[model samples]
Target: MDFVFLEDSEWKSLGEFISTKWRNKKLVILCDENTETYCLPRLLAENPDMLSGTEIISVPPGESSKSLALVEQLTLALNDLRIDRNAGLICLGGGVITDLGGFLASVYKRGIPFINVPTSLLAMIDASVGGKTGVNAGILKNQIGTFNHPEGVFVYPAFLETLPILEKKSAYGEILKHALISSVENWNHLKDIGELDEIGPKEIITSMQVKAEVVQQDFKEGGVRKILNFGHTVGHAIESWSIATSRPLLHGEAVAWGMVVEAELSKSVGLPLEQFVEIEATVRNLFEPIVLKTSDLNDLISLMGADKKNTNEQLGFVLLKNIGNPVFDQFIDSEKVLSSLKKVFEL
Candidate 1:
């Protein structure tokens, strides 16, 4: 609920910011191997005292680490470490770290305070702020999770400097999705930006504001919030499938491709052809399209059926009517969904 954005590479400001509230409390640092190496050093350097009484738990990086088994391992580790109800958790990484850590904090001791220090662009813009935390169940993305708001969210844009190129590109999918569902002005602004790699704090803050406003209005995701999932329903399926098959597409990579497929679906289901073509072109230009084998299409469809958003044995999706406009809870038939997939994959 509380958000702070940092401009520099050093995390001293963030360390000082949270120190007063958490200095005496038991602290747990939930991070991935990537962040532990690339991002954690700055925090420790800026505030040596910050990690004094803290316990650091590092998981392997990437979506594969977000699993029930890891959760069980983390839970047991937390118990063994004797982190109690009054403990505070600091989630210091990307989407996987924030999602798994937030979920752990929610379930541990029936809930404890946790602050998100989002080091990845995707987390800063989407995952870390949403209060939705969970891991994949088998091949289904976010099939198990809870709605638990963080005590605070610290955003340090300097972390972007160390981010891998692919990861930054992946984050653009969410940024594009945000623009599409936000306002025509937002979409236009992003469209005029020329290059995704050139996106700066201004653009990131604009996307965050759009997301924050929607989250403030629909925290529980019962209505308006569902629009934020415009690309995720299909995106998650492709992500989970990639993870299961060892293809390992980044979350935003799958999302970029999903937006393309879903745009095609929207057209098949009556979205204006002109709008769909423009949407498809924009998304395709922003991200490299993921190629799904013909044989894997059925499995992707099955994965989608297992999405948490689905209801009453139907596939529920958030689709676009146009840029900056989303229609949620639309049910599309399997055949139509297949058609869309084939359209995107060229199968």
Candidate 2:
């Protein structure tokens, strides 16, 4: 996928892309209520010539919008708008918008072109770059999805300014995950930052590059790309559990805790004690802990069993061998998993 880091004159490139490549295509912008309010106006003002006739589709903000029910509603909306196969979709929000919009574009009329305009830091670095699109199955995260790339990804770092403080902090979990899985140099660069405000566009681009490189090597996630799931196996289960509770944890918050738990699991695979300590400290420093009850353990485990990453009923994981090195497709027995989960939560 083509990536454009929209800076001073770079915004013009997005307009050029639309005007030249999708000039005659019916354009639609898919965003959440948040972006429709904060971002859509700026986008339209900046690219009036190219996006003049573009239609806007807005869903409510947050993870709940990622559901098959929402997808069906969106399909009907598109049909009502008379959007045809030749239309183009612009995903213009965080992960949920991009994931849902991409999935809709892929399935509508057997696939129409889509572009990603990632408004949130999380979407810019992870969701919009991976070409992975899907919605949740009930409380399960991304249980149904597809491997579909957008025609291009347009990243505007300035959009992050509109995010709430918590939202900005939440993205750091994914940033830390990328650094841990990529190299020691990247980890070192990120490990010391005390505030989310300390992270600038350069750090954001670095994280995006890490994901983009990994995706290029394993677009279908058949092998090498599994390393990117380092925190996600346990993270996803925690996220699913939190979603069902009154106090839902943001995706990155659960991931931060997952990295801590998985770092403990890394011990069984020979990860050095010192590295594990650093990983835990770094994650905990950036994110508040999620209080997990002993009663919650069984449910969390059950959620893991339903994860698509498992093989033959065994839980598959990507555990760290070192700070920069990850080992994927490691199937750990329930005994060890239980032990690690218990130990991490001090249960």
Candidate 3:
């Protein structure tokens, strides 16, 4: 319920917020190599007066960097630099940095105030605000993380200009899925948003509000929060599979495909058939459908079996009562899921 406007205007408000939240504390601005080069310098330059005692920090990028090895190193860095409970950590990149920064802030001196400055659209909408922070453990994604709230999250669409176009569209997959599973309000926002090339401040603010409402309703995801996982249950499985393979897909790309497959599966389970078709059409128009070879699908399925959401001899899912309303229902058979997937891919 601790929400703040994450916008371009508020970029320097970050320093002011930090100054107020952790008065007289040191600032630790964290970034990855890419964001350091592209986004961090501009960020630091914006509020030279605000972050007077700030130290710019960087780590090698990627989900792989979230390991215990990195955490220990960061802990050492903080200690060496004399960072104390009075200080704050500012994450100035995408989800990987957000995750690592959140974990470090939580464990560093038993928790310190932290701010999330999510640069990517995906991070802006999904990873940045939710308080779900962690690193991948072996094949598992976010297997080791925490559910600690940030002091505030600052989302600047301006930072998005530095992002690759593909990553932008990929983030759209999550935003679009939000449209599908949430409300016609979101649907209209996407449809009327002029061009996919321009998602403006309106859409960004709207997306944050939508997600904030959901997170507030179910912070721990014990019930209604399951809605947020609409595409992710299987999408994450694909994530693990992709990482294991040489051609790793971005998080949004896997979710893009996963949303399509699950929509088809929903129909097979006796939901209205048109909803599935509607879902398929919407995605196909936005993203080119990826046709997985039989072997690749097999690999993907193997990865699905390892999902933490699975139960004894059966899979669990949060299916739709209808679009905009999600429900958590158990007893999904793997064979039935595969059958539905075959229908979508025709593989």
Candidate 4:
């Protein structure tokens, strides 16, 4: 699992690696409409010789593109292009593209090699780094997927320049999650950031390192890696519920809110009130709280039931004993879960 920061001379290394490694293989660049317009040209310009023969495939942008129907269509397109087991896919967009492309490559003809060229901050620090790849099932998030690593992950920080302000802010949710679950020092560094623009390569790399270390220890998420799911359980449910509504939240935005509520849940176990307040203030400072209605609670709870982290019908969560001290696989009763949602969302 090589992670290269494609700044300055590093882009040449990527070109050389592609030229030598995928020279004889058919290469397909998978992106969304957003990346195609803003990123693909730069990629081709930088790796002209290596990617000259590569084919381009662009799907509509956003979370909706990660679906079974699109997978089927993309599969058929690959087949029509005569893509075989040796073919490689270059996922060249944000989290949704990387997740969908990785899943497609993993299952197509019993798997094909792929590399991620993540253009968004969210994908760079989280999705593209981890081996977890999947698409949503109906309204649920990542309900269908696999644990498949990419050939490599090449990140170009310049890509962030093309992202809208909201998109950039969205990534801080995961960034905050990493800091909270890793160490007090990391927390202190991130807690008082005044603007998304204040985040630089150092913050991004620190977040990526946190996740990479966790994944290395638990590639299958049998134990420690579960810590990475700190905010995801409630986050995913809220994300799913929002998907069905007219106002949809970005993945990281939902996760930020989830962390706020889950931090409240942590108090019942051992997380101190002062630490919880610190966590809540940091998250709220970075993201606006989503308005959750009383009517939404039942639907959110039902969605949580479908979470893969659950075991034997009990909802499992990763709670904090303190900032940077995460405890995973804590099962809580549905009643408490409901109460936490009510308390946080003020339902």
Candidate 5:
């Protein structure tokens, strides 16, 4: 219920961040060295007083940082600063910062308030909004986590200007989900904003709205939220499989392939083949179609079996009846999931 986006160019004002608002008692800004250097200074300069006398902390970057080691480090940092009960955490950066920092805030003093300023597209449209925050306990992507809705969220498209092209592409994969699963209008809208510079705040926020509303209805992901995981089942597995090998796929890339495979799976379930074709074309046109060998597919499938959504000892999947409508919690025929991979890899 505390979710809202900031408007006006002054949305990035750091000093004003804590003032002229319904913010908590005190704010503790969390960022990594990368965002701290590139984003914080400019933000602080504009809203000088908001962060005055506030402690800003930085952690290491990359997926590895979403580990217990990093969480321990952050806990010590908070203890040192005496950031106690009542102070809220403001996470700035991509998913890692928000996930790890938000987790830290959750465990710090047994729970406190937190806010999100997602700088990357993945975080802005998905991670930052869901309130699923945590660090990887081992090989799991989000093995140890808690669902703690941030006090507030602010997304700036300008933050993406410094994002690497790969990272930008990663975020786009999620945006594609917004369209394919819920609104074909969003799918059509994506044609105009393929490039990062071309992406506007309004469009990004709109994309987020689709997801936000879904989660608002099913915050625990008990029902409607499952639609949001349309491609994620296979995607997360592929991502983990890819990471375990010499090559690691960024989250977006894996999901891109997952969507392709699921689109085919959709067809096998009676969704017209044209829907499949459009899905394949749209994803390949946007992302480099991943070509996994027999071994990679085997490993990926093995990983998928471990998915939490599995029921009746069978794979449970969500596929589209058509664009703009998603059917969830259905048991997809195993052969369909496999055969579709053949078509996907043929590309």
Candidate 6:
């Protein structure tokens, strides 16, 4: 429940904070190649003694690294490092780092304390704050993860300036999804921002708060939390299928496409046509259109069938009634799903 929003230069403070809070604790830094190169030096310099009694482990960059095999590798490495139950994990990178690091911490020694130092905008707003941690199970996104909250979360906005443009845009997808599901005010606020790259710490804080409020209410995703899955149902499906069969889409990019598809579904299900179009247009403005062939739709539909959100073999969704309002666990007919896909792809 602890989320700290800090300036990019403030990341150096984290070393001191960890030293003071977790005195005598073994420190294991879980980073990706990207963070090791770009972020680790700053962290090490700020806390000159930070590397002492610390084991730095680097996972390969990208979603491909989120696998059971890598988890085993990390687990075995931690064991070899002789980190006991008093050890702490510091996830230092983007969503992939937080997800893999957090999950590893949760399972090692039946659960240990972990901290998140999020570098990417996407991780700052979503993955870093939430305790949900896991690697992808096969083609499915986060099919195996635990709801293990971190001891703390530290977000450094400066790291975002180093991100590639597409990475920032991918992060924007989650922020845009937050506005769509939370409030008309949030949606309108973002519409005024124009470009996604223009989003700053203030905007990041706003998006993080939206998720924080939701996670506080439904930590285990029993009821109200399901609304957070608004775009993820189809989003994860497209992400999983694409990674397994074709070029992989970034998590946020796939989610953006999911919102587009679900927006169409919302319109067909009797949401006010005007509101649906407004939501669609706003999302489209932030992200470019994604092209999915008819064949892709078939694979996507099959992928959706295996989504964790499905119950009793019925594919469910969190669709919008209007901006700031969402309806969860709604089932749509397969024909309607196909029709929506065709509409989205203009097939």
Ranking by TM-score: 5, 3, 2, 4, 6, 1
Per-residue lDDT for 27 in model 1?
88
Worst 10 residues of 2 by lDDT: 306-315
Which candidate wins on TM-score? 5
Q: Per-residue alpha-carbon lDDT of model 3 for 1-347, expressed as tens digits?
A: 44566666656567667657667878899999999999987887887788766888899977788887798899999999998988889988888899999998989889987888888888898788878888878756678878998888887888888898988887888887788778867776685663568787777777777787888888898887777777776788777667766677777878977887777666645557776776777777777666566676555665676343342345667676566766666447776777666777787
Model 1: how far residue 135 lies from native, Å = 2.9
The digit string of per-residue lDDT tens for model 5 on 232-338 reads 87898788877666668888888988988887787755777777787778777787656678656556665778332342245778888888878898776455565
| Residue pairs in clash, model 4 | none
Q: Write the per-residue lDDT of candidate 6 for residues 1-347, one digit (tens) a residue.
A: 45464655655557666768888798989999999999888777767776676789998899899898999988899999998899999999999999998899888889889999898988999988867999998866688889998888888787776788889988888998999989989988888877876798888888988899898998989988898888887898888776764467888888988888888898755678887777677767776677777777767777788343342345689988888888888888766777787987788
- Say which prediction, candidate 4 or candidate 5, comes out ahead on lDDT: 4
- Candidate 5's C-alpha runs over 4 A off are 12-17, 21-24, 192-196, 244-246, 306-313
Candidate 3 Cα misplacement greater than 4 A, ranges? 9-12, 191-195, 243-246, 268-271, 295-298, 306-313
User: What local lDDT score does residue 23 receive in model 4, on the 0 to 100 scale?
Assistant: 72
lDDT of 2 by residue, 1-347 (tens): 35545553348778888888888899999999999999999998888778887899999998899999999999999999999999999999999899999999989888899999999989988889988999999866789999998888888887888989888878888999999999999998888775789888789888999999999999998899999988888998998899778888887888888888888999988899999998888877777777889888877877888433342356889999998899999888765777788988889
lDDT of each: 0.82, 0.87, 0.77, 0.87, 0.78, 0.83
Say which candidate scores most in lDDT: 4
TM-score of 6: 0.88
TM-score to true structure, per model:
0.84, 0.90, 0.90, 0.89, 0.91, 0.88
- Local lDDT at 77 for model 4: 97
Candidate 1 structure, TM-score to reference = 0.84
Task: Return the number of clashes found in candidate 4.
Answer: 0
Off by over 4 Å in 4: 4-10, 244-246, 293-299, 306-314
Best of the two (1, 2) by lDDT? 2
